[model samples]
Target: MFKLAGQLASDCIVLGDFQLCTLLLMNDAQYPWFILVPRREDATEIFQLSVADRSLLMEESCLLAEKLKDAFAADKMNIAALGNVVSQLHVHHVVRYRKDHAWPAPVWGKSPAVSYTPELLNERIGKLRAVLTNGFTFAESCP
Candidate 1:
């Protein structure tokens, strides 16, 4: 019964599913950001997850952070799971650089999210998919 929220579906590009979570790329082109949502219905907090699922989420988050850092050569990887907005059990992995648009500050609210052109969106997703497929066992689920 797990389903992505309407706001999430509107703002993210579906990447693929991990063993316990669905991976999504935030639609904002300003940063190399990804979100991981556990495939559990109506669970809004980390504590709501079972102990094993909590451990699995950490493992998945770490692996994704490493891969994103490698793929984008990011100076830092910001991983968080603040649910103030969507109230879903999701983790965010954002690849950051010292010279990025919102350097020295958080990316949220620094600038408006830039929408991607069709070609650019496809290219970005393809690059990410390549890295994920090479590093993990996820099959592409996004068109």
Candidate 2:
């Protein structure tokens, strides 16, 4: 499972590079989405991290979720770590709304991916990255 392309072999799916996880953007645009990929060499599970790293990862997840909540003014935050689809040991932290496309249900397999405009994507990423940097600093390998 080891890919030597560095931490971001794919689009970041979570908050920002400030944490051990990278943020991935789901192709859907109806909701604010993100994924967190822990920067470990072919890590397969959260428990695989050292005790200290595990604790930090959890803390970072929670904190980043909070930031997403505030920044997006979202109604709820969906945080999950399911490796069934992509087995790179990545986590998901998504902002949800009552009126979103997959409202009142899970977002998975609900619809096709919605593309984002480059300008919009860049703006949103910049804002989220700012929040991430407020209290977190990225290791060289992370960014």
Best by lDDT: 1
Count clashes in each candidate, considering only residues at least 3 apart in sequence or on different chains. 0, 10
Structural RMSD, model 2 = 3.8
Question: What's the distance in Å from true for residue 143, model 1?
Answer: 4.1
* lDDT for each residue of candidate 2 in 36-128, tens digit (9 for 90 to 100): 667788687888899987987887788888889999998989888877767777777779899888887888788876767766776777677
Q: Candidate 1 lDDT, tens digit per residue, 18-60?
A: 8888888899988888999999999999999999999989888
Residue 110 of model 1 has an lDDT of 94
Q: How well does candidate 1 match the true structure in TM-score terms?
A: 0.91
RMSD (Å) per prediction: 1.8, 3.8
* Model 2 spans with C-alpha error above 4 angstroms: 1-16, 135-143
Best by TM-score: 1
Report every candidate's CA lDDT: 0.86, 0.70
How far in Å is the alpha carbon of 100 misplaced in model 1? 0.8
